[model samples]
Target: MKLFNSLLLVLIIVLNFMFAEPSLADPPKITKSPDYVEVTKSLDILQGQLAATKSGQARSETLSAEDLQKKIDELSFQKYALEKGINWGQCRNETDKTIAVYGPKPKKPKTPYDNTLYFLGAGQATPTNWDCQGIYLPNDTKLTSLNTDPNQQLEGAIAIKIFKGTQLIAKNDPETGALELNISPSKFFKSGEINWYIPNVSERNIAFRVPDVPLGGEEETD
Candidate 1:
C-alpha cells in the first residue's frame, strides 16, 4: 500500500508539470493609434492560431506546428515595432457598441479631414505601438464606419473655432490654462467623457452650427 501511494504521488507531480499552462500575457501598452490597433489585432489572431495548433485543435489541420510558429514570430516582430516602449495615451472602447475615432487634423489642410478614423468595436483597446496625440470622440454630427467619402464626412463636423477649437474638445474657462480636457488610457463613458456639445460659442465665424444632439439617429450613434 505504501509503495502504491508513493508511486501515485510521483505520477501526480509529473502530470502537473507536464500539463501546466503558461500565465496569460499582459495587454500591449502602446498608443491607441490606427497602426497600433491593426497590428495588435493581427498579432492576436496569429498567436491564437499557433496556440490552437499546439493543442491539436482544428487549426492544427490547416497549419503545421512549424508553419504556425513562423507566422507568429513574424507578427510578433511587427507588434514590437509598433510598441512605443511605454504605456501612455491608451484608450479603450468601453461601450457595448462600436464608436468612431479621429486623430488631430493635419497642420495643413491639403486633404479634407476624414472626420472618422475607424470604428472601434466593443471591449477593444488601443495598442502600444505608435505615439498617440489623443483621440477625439464625437457626440454630434457623427460619422460612422460606413462613411468613406472625405468630402461628405465634414457635414456638421466640428467647426474650426477661436476658443474651444471645436466640439467634444472645449475647455471650461475657454482659455489656455484649464483642466477641462480629459486624459487617455481611460474608459470612455465610464466616468465622464468629454465629447462634442455643439453650442453657439464654438465658431460663429463658420456661420453655421449643428445641434448638440444631432437630428438624425447617430446618438457615436457611442
Candidate 2:
C-alpha cells in the first residue's frame, strides 16, 4: 500500500509538470511554408525578367509594350500581396478586386517639373490657398518681375522683395545672374509676384506669381 501511494504521488507530480504552460525560453520555432519559398523564387525570376525587358535584352523574339505592361501589372499585384502579409497560396488565387480590398495600395507617381514657373499643389494652377506657397526656379534661371495685386505696382528696385499682403517681410540683393530662392513659403502672402532681372546683356526678365485662394484670384487682385 505504501509503495502504491508513493507511485501515485510521483504520477501526479509528472502530470502537473506536463500540463504546465511553457516558459519564455521554450518558444515555438517559426518555419516558412513551402508555398512561401516557391512564391519568393517566382518573384525573383519575375524581377530578373523585368530587368532584362527594361535593358532591351529580353529573351523573347519580340516583346510588345502591351505584354510588358501586363507583366508589370502582375508584379505590382504580387508585391502588394507580399507587403500585406498575405500567405503565398492565398495571394496566388486572389482576384484583383480581392487584392484591392485586402492588399496594400500602390503609391502615386511623383510629378516631374522642368525649367518653368508654376503653382505647387494639385499639379495645376487653380488658385489654391496661400498658407505656404512660392515658386520653384530651376538652377541657372533668372527672376524677372516683382509686384503686388490690387496695385500692379512693379518693385522696380534692383533687389529681392518678399511681401505679405503689401507688407514687405524680407529683402535681399544677391545681384547674381543665377539665383535660386528656397525660402519658407509662409513668408509671402497671396497674389504676389517676383521678377528676376537676368543680368545678361539682354537684361531679360521672368515673372512668377504666388498662389491665392478663390474669390481673390490673380486676375481679380491684379
Candidate 3:
C-alpha cells in the first residue's frame, strides 16, 4: 500500500510539472504598445463569411447570381474599412455632482458614462478653489452642464475640454474621423475597463494613430 501511494504521488507531480511548462510561441512585439490584432481578426471573419456566401450561392437555387454579387461588394467594403482601422479618441471625466453628456445622434444610450472608453478628469465638487482644466466657475454655473447636451454631437477630430463643476481638468486631442467620449462619474474614472467606446465602434471610426498626448502634460492622456 505504501509503495502504491508513493507511485501515485510521483505521477501527480509529474503531470503537474508537465502541464505547468510555459508556451514556446514567440511573444507579440506589440505587447508593450497598443496594436489592433482583434480588429484584424474581425476582418478575417468577415472575409470568411463573404467567401462562404459566394460558395452558398453556387449551390443555392434561391439566391440569384446578381444578389450574391451585391453581398460580396457590401461585405468587401466593410472588410476594407476594418483593415483601414478607425481612429477614435475618448475620455472619462468625473464629479461628485451629477455629470451630463450628449451626442452620437440616434442616441441608443440614454445617459452619460453608459459604457465607453474615455480619458478621466476630475473637477471641483464644491464651489471655492474649484480648479478643473485651469478654469473657475460661479457657484450656480454647475460644471456638469458643459458637455451635457446630447442634442449636440461633436464630430471629426477635435480637442475636447472636460469639466466637473467650474473647472477644466483634462483635454482630448482632435483626430480626422469618428470617435466616442466618456465624461462622467468624476471618480473611478482611471481604471482601464471603463474604456469608453471600444466595442461600439461603427461607421464613423477613425484611427487614433498618434500617441495620446501632444506637447502638453501626460495627464492630458489616459
Candidate 4:
C-alpha cells in the first residue's frame, strides 16, 4: 500500500511539471512541426484509390480518372513544397472568421502562453516569431474567432508590421538528411483542413488551394 501511494505521488508531480508553462529563456523546439505526414499518408491512400479506379475495382461518384490524377498531382506538389521547408514568417488569415492558433508545437503544437494566444482576425495576417520550417492544419482542425475592437487593443499587444518578400529556404529529405532545392512558401492561411504553412512558409504551395500573393515587407515576389 505504501509503495503504491509513493509511486502515485511521484507520477502526479511529473505530470504537473510536464504540463507547466514554458519559459522564453528555454524556448521549445517544434516537436510536431507540421510535416504533413498524415496528409502524405492520405495521399498514399488516394493513390491506392487511383490504382483501384484504373483496375475497375473502384470508382468515385463524382470524379473521373482525369480528376483523380489532377488531385494527386496537386497534392504531390504541396508535399514537395513543404518537404523543402519554409522561412520563419507570418500567417495571414484569409478567412472571414477569427482564428486562435497554438504553435505547430503546430514547440512548432505548438504552444500558447496564457496571453500569447494569437487571434487572427478575419482577412488580417499576423507575423510569427516561430523558427519552424513547416506548418500543417488537419481537416478536422477546428478554428475559432474572437471579437475585439482596434481601439481596444490588448495591454501588451505589439505593433503590426508587414514583412517583405519571402525568404528562400531549402527543403531537406527527412530520411536521407540530404539537402534538396529551395523555395519561398506562401503566407496565406484560409479555410479547409489539410493545411500546412505559416510560422514558416511563403509562396502558397499548400494542400488548401489558396492563391500566391506577395507578403509585402520586402520587394514583390512570386
Candidate 5:
C-alpha cells in the first residue's frame, strides 16, 4: 500500500510539469530614428568643439584653422537638420509646438551692414564752442565717442547738438569725455547732422557713426 501511494504522488508531479505554460520573453526595445540618432551624435560633437574653443579663448588663444572650419561645418549641418524638421532629442509633439511658435527661423538675410557700425572719422573740437557739422544717419542711430587725445584731459561738460534748419532740437551732455548718444527717429526726422560742443576750455577728440539695422525687427524702446 505504501509503494502504491508514492507512485501516485510521483505521477501527479510529472503531469503538472508537462501541462505548465512556458514564460513569455520581453518585448524588443524600440530605437530612435536614423535621423534622430544622427542629430544627437552631431550635437554631442558640436558641444565638445564649442567647449574646446571656449577654453582656448579663455586662455587668449584662437582655435586652429582646421578646428574653426570643423566648427563651421558642424553648425551648417545643424542648420540643415533643423530646416529638415529634425529636433535635437525633443519629442515630436514638443518639436511641433516649438516650430509653430517660432516658425522656420532660418538664417537671417544678409544685409549690407549687418551688425556693423562704420567709423566715420575722429577729430578735435574746441570747448564752449559748437560746430554745426552735417552728417547722415539712419533712424534710431547710436553714436559712441572716446577721447583719443592723450594731451587733453576731460575736465568739463560736453554736449551733442541735434539741429533742424539751424534750430537746436535736442542736446545731450555726456559730462565725461567718453560718450554715447542714442538718436531716435522722432528727434532726428528732418536732419542727420549733429554738432559736438564742449562748454569749457578742454578740447574733445570725437568719433561718430551709425549702427546697422537689426535683422528681425525694431528693438523695444523704453
Candidate 6:
C-alpha cells in the first residue's frame, strides 16, 4: 500500500511539470506580410529609376520588359496606398484660398525740414493768416513776389536766402529781375536756403518754402 502511494505522488509531480512547461508550438508572430516586403522593394527600385532618369541614364529602349513591369507594379501599389489613405480618413484637406497676409503698413519716408521752415510774407497783409509769405533762405537773399498759384508758382525752386556768419556767399540779385533761378546745392548754407530779396515792405514774397510737414503733401500758407 505504501509503495503504491509513493508512485502516485511521483506521477502527480511529473504531470504538474509537464503542464508548467511552455508550449513548443508558437502563436502567430507579428510579421510584415510578403506583399509589404515586395511593395517596399518596389519603392526602392522606383526611386532608383527616377534618379537614373534625372541623371539622363534611363531610356525606354534600354529598359527590359521585366524592369518596365516592375515600375508599373510599383505605381499600382502607390495608387493603392493613396486609396487606402482616403478610405481610412488619413488624407488631408486641400485649401486654395489665398489669405492676404498684410504686414504692418510700411512707414512713410521722412523729410529734412519737416517742421523747420516757415512762410513770413503773408504776416504783413493777413496778420495771423499769411499768403505769399517771404521764406528766409540760408543764402542771405529774400524772396519777394513768391506766388502760390498752382499753375504758375515755382514748385521746388528756391526763392530766397538766409545767411549765417559773414554772408560770404553773395545774395541773389533780384535787380537782375528774378531770372530763371537755378537753385544749386549749397555747402555754406546750414540747410540749403534759396535766397531772394523783397523790394516792397507792404507785400511778402512766397519763396519756395519748405513745409512744416515736408515729406508727403504740399504745404499750405494761410
User: Which candidate ranks first by lDDT, i.e. highest?
Assistant: 4
Q: Which stretches of candidate 2 lie over 4 Å from their true place?
A: 1-31, 62-66, 86-222
Residue-level lDDT tens digits of model 1 in 1-222: 999999999999999877877356455445465546765676687788878777867566556878767766765664565573532334344544443344333334333333323334445554442222344333232223213431233333332211111112222223322213332111223112233222222122221322121112233211
Per-model TM against the reference: 0.26, 0.22, 0.23, 0.36, 0.17, 0.18
lDDT string for model 3 (1-222, tens) is 999999999999999878875567565443221323433454465456556666774344554556545555644553444344332222223332222221122233344443222222233122222112212111222123233543344232122323212223322223311122333322222123443322323221322222122113222122
Tens digit per residue, CA lDDT, model 6, 62-158:
5664665666574565445533422111101011111000011123333333222333221111122112212333222233333222124233323
Q: For model 4, what is the alpha-carbon lDDT of residue 203?
A: 20
Candidate 6 accuracy as lDDT? 0.33
Candidate 5, pairs of clashing residues: 128-198
Per residue, candidate 5 scores C-alpha lDDT tens digits across 1-222 of 999999999999999778866446343222244434544565576566666666774321455546655755754554455445422221011110000000111145433321211122222111112222222323222234323442343333323322211211222234532223223211221212222212122111122223222222333211
Is 1 or 4 the stronger prediction by lDDT?
A: 4
Q: How far in Å is the alpha carbon of 122 misplaced in model 6?
A: 99
The lDDT of each candidate is 0.40, 0.33, 0.33, 0.41, 0.32, 0.33
Clash totals, every prediction: 8, 9, 28, 25, 1, 22
Better of 2 and 6 by TM-score: 2
| lDDT score for residue 67 of model 6 | 67
Shift of residue 209 alpha carbon in model 5, Å: 66
Higher-TM-score candidate of 4 and 6: 4
lDDT at position 126, candidate 1: 40
lDDT of 4: 0.41
lDDT of 4 at 12: 99
> Residue 196, candidate 6: how far off, in angstroms?
99
The deviation in Å at residue 142 for candidate 1 is 41
Regions of candidate 6 where Cα sits further than 4 Å from its true position: 1-31, 60-222
